[model samples]
Target: MRRAFFYGWVIVATLFVVNFATHATGNMNLGLFVIPMSDEIGISRGLFGWLTTSRTLAAGLASIVIGRLVDRFGARILIPASALITGLGVIAIGSATNVVQLFVLFAVIGFGGLSPQGGGLLTSVPVAKWFVRKRGTAMAVTSMGLALGATTFVPVTQFLIGAVGWRRAWFYLGIISMTMIVPTALTFLRRQPEDMGLRPDGDADSRLGSGAAQRSEAADEAVWTLGTALSTRAFWMLTAALALGGFAAGGGVHRIPYWIDSGFDHDLVSLSISVHAASAATVMLAVGILLDRVPARFVAAGPFAGFSIAIVIMLSADSNTDMFASAVIWGMSAGTGIVSQPYLWASYFGRSFLGTIRGVTMPTILVATSLGAPAMGYVFDFRGSYDLAWQVVVAIYAAAFLIMVSVSPPRLGRPLAD
Candidate 1:
């Protein structure tokens, strides 16, 4: 396979491992600890959810810093540092005994190691750099690492938490982070293809007799910088749609607790989340390939519709089967969105500026995602049902879907003709 395989694929596989480990310790996995940690620490559900808010706030800030680092220094440094910080944070989580501890520790985790599954913008920049023609497929497949992490970690954490305790689960994850992710980041990762004497997608050397020195993509391709992209109406529209989508996706944090509260079995709730992640992982390759071949907006829009339908199903679910059904649909849609966002950026604006551009847009997405958990918790705390939060999520998804369908790529000098 080496004879025909792209080195970019090697980079992808390494990032897959890095993402799997980082995401396994992320807030999504914290859903498993909602009841245990809150009960043990003697905090309200709404208060516990605020810890997620703190974590998101921390990551949102860190993303901006890391974004500059990514563009300047590259993933080789950031990925490992993020992993180590995340590991220490996870290990420290076991020691948390109060809301203060929870807030600080989770914030640390957010800063050190949260990707929302692409290690925030760190992973996306590299993918944008390495695979232009196949960026969609590469991102789709690579993004599966998060779902796969969830698929594996959710069930394992459930068991570990059930057996030894949540504390031990965090401890075990920290060990894995240090041992696995640290080495992988150091050895398997590279900054970009050019350093290795290759071109994006390994494009042919225009000079036949010469070695792999390649032509630049274009001198006038008009990469959208942060300021220029911000000037466009398309930027705001995509931001609005994605922020809402992010808010809706935040449903993952409270998924276990929501089901458990609705008289659903604890084991079943865990299984539903695991199955959801698995379902998303299952279609990631297909979505990746589809993004390469289709109009990304068209591909992106279906998931938002699925998100709406899934919320409707959640509203009336009566059994574990119903919850699982809803999760599958939601997971598939979530999977599609993860891959499409990066593809859309690369395709629409060009790859040269992806790191900075993504950095600019990330805070809203992360903040919106943060809002979901606390909103669900607050509504449930007040109303004693998840009904209100789900209702709001449904509306957001509807609005997001409409906005996404209406958006077009930003042009170089155009301001707001839309």
Candidate 2:
């Protein structure tokens, strides 16, 4: 029976790998194409930024709805369908002839590809529901997909763009996304371990020992409602902090090439992205270990501080060494920032309504990021430098830090009420 829990973890790890692959494939493909697409479509890079904004907006809006759907149905139904839609959208993007077509195709992709509420939500919520004792570690392992995807695919997509045109690269990627995700999702993504006649961690007798006994106690707790969570000051503070962090991170990340355009080489620019992903992965792993043991506010502050320092360095740096430093600092912060929000959500709200709560919170934050992306591009196009943009991002991060510091966890004894 103990082996059953390990099998569940094995499933979680497998899904994480798949999730990471798809995300990396999409992001790296888009980054590689952004400049070429602008040139080919005869649109300003600022205007082209709408492609991402459209995707993010659609995904954000879809999150809560998808979360409800997951609760009503199951991941087995949603994950494969989302993957197929994402693949189809990728194919459509490859076939697009004009800016209008590109926008429409990417919107479809955004709806399918960018719905974190669907894939990650489906994976993590179920896993969290099952494993009480090791929930933090499990979530961290699953979230690693985001970092792994970015690190592995950035270089590959860069190479693909160099070898074939971006269109052909997208075409090949579409085929790959469809072939891989469809089958694996169908086979492995069950609604719960109980569907297989096993508990979350596969303990046939989870109520046996004091250490293992906590599992039943956690499982018996009431799930939080969206309304009750919203009523808490902690929720508002977390949402504000997350939104500000998103704005800052999105603004800088979407404009990485603009910084490179100032005087850096393409390889160096790509390396910055890779470093950012790598650092984020490392930080997330560290935070995963700390999340259960430490206060949530400190975890939130660590990333914001890292981001602030990185931005300051980036704004000051004129050389490769400085850029490298900037990447490491910012990358680590970005990683921690990404993982910490979800950790906080679980910490503050509990696992029952995680999907719905996250669904609601994610869109608001992503929309901020969506707006930030194009706005930063416009800043570059208008101001001809990322100098002003970096300063703005630094301020945003500062605001997020302040918000986090002011917030505290909800009182432990109250039952979550709608």
Candidate 3:
């Protein structure tokens, strides 16, 4: 019997919550902890910034193993386990007395929870596997969690730090992480639609059985394995483009600190994060539809171009008006970037081996990302300004934009259609 509603949408919703909860602990909110923790612990900004670097580096290395597990066992086991580990790790961070403790916990438990599958990678892959025609829309919806998490958590963390202490704030947020993520993930997530006897996009099975020709066509759909995909020019170019984008994206870790240094009120700095996230959330649905309709390369280029311009605006800004305007532009661009990378991976290579394909790229992307924030912090430490760091990020964005525009999907076998 045909089910009245698609189960894939349920999968999308589950991953949405996963994205939301996991990102609440992500580096975007690190600025909230940076000043307070560094002040209390007497660590320099450059040294404290290594927490993000450690987390990303560990997550990148773990992605090599986790990616294959996701492909083989699915996210059902991995995501919840990661969340559980993440929750305990985050709570442990509350009691940390030194840089070493923070580094070890964040790197191991935090990275274990969020990388390869949880943070954005695993959540996106399952959604991609569940839909083809609707892949872009599903991805757009899933990515809303990322925006929402930032929009809510930045201010909430800011408020919590003010009302209580940063340590207690960490405890509360960690509790929330486990409460929101672990139970739902265990209850709802499944490997793919096929495991439940459903086809991608909820297409009627009868369509494929209509004739011999259709059966042949279905059998001929392109399948790109990790080994073969790595051999293609598209793979390397896309990897370079995404890795550069990852590095640029990490600049968020210092955004709050930069604003505060620029003499903005603390509340105003937090508000800027909300504005950026809200703008990204608002544009994401439209970007998703555009991704489905537009050529993949053009859609991929939009974020890089937007980031370049946005950073330039931010560097020159001296007023509150200019700051918020920069945030809006970055938000719009970031929304597209969040959706485009995974969409490109699945659409370009096909979905069967998405976990493995995305996994292999993790180390390069995470390592590049790991470098960005500390680079900014150390620049500020040594130079007394963030001027040089933003300049470097702008160049990285330009490079990514050029590479992204040049990329075309690799032709493997018969084309896979939406």
Candidate 4:
């Protein structure tokens, strides 16, 4: 049974690695390809920005549906299937001939690639389902995949883009994403601990009993229907905070190159972006450890503070050193923000309905990101700088900080009924 529990951890770890790869591949590739794709296709940066928007929009819309599917069917089917489709979409992007083709292809990729699987949603839900006492730690550890992917894959993709050109990089990434992520998911991921004749948190012999008995016991756990979650003040607060946070973060992602355009060497700019990934990954791991020992709300707040300060520094900085420092701060904060929210949902609501709730939450947050991306790009196109956008982001982060502080953890022992 202990070995079985260990296997569960292994499954989480595998998903973590895959999440890291997919995120790194998805995000970093865009920045690397921006110039080449734009030059080849004769589209403005603002127009090209829609590719990302499409991806986010598709992802946002699909997350809820995918969550419902995962709940009804299981991760064993949903995860691997999404991966395969995502890989095909990546290949499609590589093969795209025109802007329309790219747009349609990436919309498919977004559907396949963008849904909240791989690490945060995918691993967190299943892992949370398996372990209650250790849920925070598990989420933190698994979410580190995002950071790890950013850390490792950014530099690697940077090298690939430089060496093989962006098109080949997409092809290689597509194949690798499919081959690696799909098999690992198929072999390891299980929907619930009960499938293995165990109970959540290894309590097979405890008050919950085993198998059917544990399932019966778990039936009483808080199950918030969609209406109840929507009606709660806490839910709106969380949604607002996360949505603003996404706007700030997404705006920055869209505008990073523009920031670099302000007198820094392009390679140095890429290095700075890579630094953000590395910092995010490191901070995520540290925060994950800390989350295991501290109040999650406090852990969540730390990132907002760091992010706000980083924006201030970025606005003030004129040199590479300042930019690098800003990247570290922002990266760390962003990493924390990404990991903290899912845990927040689990703690505030209930894990049983997490996928569905996250599905609803995801669209709002992603739409903010999608709109922010192109809007920031347009700001740069018109104003020739990202100063105004950054100012707005700073304000948004401040609001997020306040909102996060206002969030009270839900009462843990009772089921919240609609």
lDDT of each: 0.77, 0.71, 0.81, 0.72
Deviation of model 3 at 361, angstroms: 1.0
Candidate 3 residues 1-418, lDDT tens each? 4567888989988888887886556445768888889899887777776788888888887777777787777888888888888888888898999889988987976467463222366688788878888889999999998888889888988888999999988888889888998889899998866666567777644333324433333443477888889989999999898889888877677888888888988898889888898888998889889888987788978998898887888888899998999889989888888888789888888777788888888889888887887878899899999888899898989999999999987887544453
TM-score of 4: 0.91
Candidate order, lDDT descending: 3, 1, 4, 2
Q: Candidate 2, clashing residue pairs?
A: 5-201
- The numbered model that scores best in TM-score is 3
Better of 1 and 4 by TM-score: 1
Report the candidate with higher TM-score, 2 versus 4.
4
Question: Can you rank all candidates by TM-score, best first?
Answer: 3, 1, 4, 2
| TM-score, candidate number 2 | 0.90
lDDT of 2 by residue, 106-200 (tens): 67876773344222565666666555556667777877877777787777778877899887878777777777777887887776555455565
Q: What would the TM-scores of all predictions be?
A: 0.93, 0.90, 0.93, 0.91
Which of candidates 2 and 3 reaches a greater lDDT? 3
Error of 2 at 253 (Å): 4.2
Query: Which pairs clash inside model 1?
Result: 115-119, 115-120
Which regions in candidate 2 have their CA more than 4 angstroms from the true location? Answer: 1-5, 113-120, 202-220, 416-418
Q: In terms of lDDT, which candidate is stronger, 1 or 3?
A: 3
Cα error of candidate 1 at position 381, Å: 0.9
Cα displacement (Å) at residue 114, model 2? 4.4
Give the C-alpha lDDT of model 2.
0.71
